[model samples]
Target: QGTRELVGKVAEALASLPPVTVYEPEYVPKPPVVDTSEPLDIQRLDDGHTWLIQGPWLQRLMANVNFDDYESRMWFDKTLRESGLYQQLEERGIEDGDTVSLDGYEFEYQY
Candidate 1:
């Protein structure tokens, strides 16, 4: 009898509670614009070298003789020389045989 009375009280209390309100978000659509007039330029630098300069940097491609060496040495050297460390050293008056230390790595400029 006590358990039934308690259950009845709980039901009455639940029935007296106010209803909850819910909110739903609206969706907005966005479309991208693309230009199709200009075509990609594929240039042949030489018999074995070809370069494709696209609109996006990731889309750019290069086919060269000895690509492995080119990627390892030429690209690595170019990117390294263009880095902030190299620029900072240059601004600080770097000279031949000057050693530069950055982020625990050290490099000596010979020319």
Candidate 2:
């Protein structure tokens, strides 16, 4: 009786998982070369950090969710925003800033 009850509970838990489907979505990768050809500028603003060029560049507008919960989060935010990409990340996911292969395109992100 004990074993049967355990098996039933396990079955119920497993059944809660989602069903798999074959509908795969298309994923466009980022450009092989950013074509930036120029170094980005870094700035320490009063609020958010800015890393970009005068004309074109990648920009990350970050917002700290919980300032007290984690110190690493703040550190990472500061570190990455000061990295090379700045606003030129290959794998960026800032809502509209979806990653797209920059195969020979000369366009900046505009909302």
Candidate number achieving the greatest lDDT relative to the actual structure: 1
Where model 1 places Cα greater than 4 Å from the true spot, the runs are 1-73
Clashing pairs in 2: 29-101, 30-100, 30-101, 31-101, 31-102, 58-87, 59-87
Q: What lDDT score goes with residue 47 in model 2?
A: 31
Alpha-carbon RMSD to native, per candidate: 18.4, 14.0
Global lDDT of each candidate: 0.43, 0.41
> Over the stretch 22-91, how does candidate 1's per-residue lDDT look in tens digits?
8787653322223323443333234322222233321221221123554443553453354333454455
C-alpha-based local distance difference test score of model 2: 0.41
Candidate 1: C-alpha RMSD to true structure equals 18.4
